[model samples]
Target chain A: MQLSTRNQLKGTIKEIKKGPVSTEVIIDVSAPAEVVASITTGSADSMGLKVGEDVTALVKASSVMIMK
Target chain B: MQLSTRNQLKGTIKEIKKGPVSTEVIIDVSAPAEVVASITTGSADSMGLKVGEDVTALVKASSVMIMK
Candidate 1:
């Protein structure tokens, strides 16, 4: 799929934590680096995300904040 | 500063590419992984982002997407 965002990281599903309305998915991009994504529970369930699955984390540059 | 987003990656500024209205900041989070952020040039100049500066890349889970 084409994405407008420029940052894309390929990683495997490390963990999945579910909340009432949101689901937290931790992706192991590398040894020391991981990307945490909070998506809707409905989206998560529909996607059938599981541990050990390879997923790409898409982050829009506009959504990224640079703090000193 | 407290942010509502959960994903925070600590990295060093590697390069800064400027556009008319937006600035693209590429950060090296790890050896192979980099996070690119696009923010307004005004905010970029006001923040004075430079190469070799330490910055945190904050991504709101809401803005993160997982593609299988």
Candidate 2:
């Protein structure tokens, strides 16, 4: 909703992959491909998420260290 | 790290809140507080998160809808 939020990325659900243990979800962020980061919701569930759904990806940038 | 995956919640970092733009991260999960679901990492950053860090909270539990 608010892009001003530091680690929050709101987007529409592009895909949902359910695994035996975890689920992989992809979101289509508004930022360009450069600024946009692909986050993985590492879990599977029978509720809430679905294709075309709007959701927020809360990322703690610190946890997302750039490996160089 | 692999608590059956469904809505992956790996515990480590305890607190990180930096405002002005957005950054509020708190992760101390272990499935005790009744399935342990307290995820919020909106966003703020200088590098990677600190404060006894260890991060992994990727939940897509159907957007977590539970209303009565």
Candidate 3:
């Protein structure tokens, strides 16, 4: 589970929920609420996450690249 | 994206770094530094992420479940 990438941020597993096939995990970050809002609008689930659970949401490194 | 699990978090892509095969994305959340630390310990890359990139890190809903 030792990731080797460089980009690292700090957050908490604010919530955790279960679904028919998969489980959901949420992290509360320290960035702008709006930014998180936008990401959530297209990246979050529907069953509603839990209130407390430590987890990390990993995005594939290649999926995102520098714009400028 | 359009992830539909349950747990939703709020954070910013603080950094983005490139790797030999994939890119690295870093998100800054609003949770405990320690929690994020542990997760990052086993969840981040090594190529060094960017400084300002809005992204959403999605974890499989089933990967996380309710403890109680």
Q: What is the TM-score of chain B alone in each candidate?
A: 0.51, 0.25, 0.35
What ordering of candidates by DockQ runs from best to worst?
1, 3, 2
Q: By TM-score, how accurate is candidate 2?
A: 0.26
RMSD of 1: 18.4
- In model 1, the runs with Cα more than 4 Å from the true position are A1-31, B1-31
> What TM value does chain A in model 2 reach?
0.38
- Docking class for candidate 3: incorrect
lDDT of 3: 0.32
> A14-63 in candidate 2: lDDT tens per residue?
88788663456666768643233333445425344676766665665223
Per residue, candidate 1 scores C-alpha lDDT tens digits across B3-59 of: 433444554444434444433334444534445555666666666655555555556
Instruction: Tell me candidate 1's fraction of native contacts, as a decimal between 0 and 1.
Output: 0.30
Worst 10 residues of 2 chain A by lDDT: A59-68
Interface RMSD for each candidate model?
A: 17.4, 12.6, 14.9
Every candidate's CA RMSD = 18.4, 17.2, 15.2
Indicate the residue-level lDDT of A62 in model 2. 23
DockQ numbers for every candidate?
A: 0.14, 0.02, 0.07
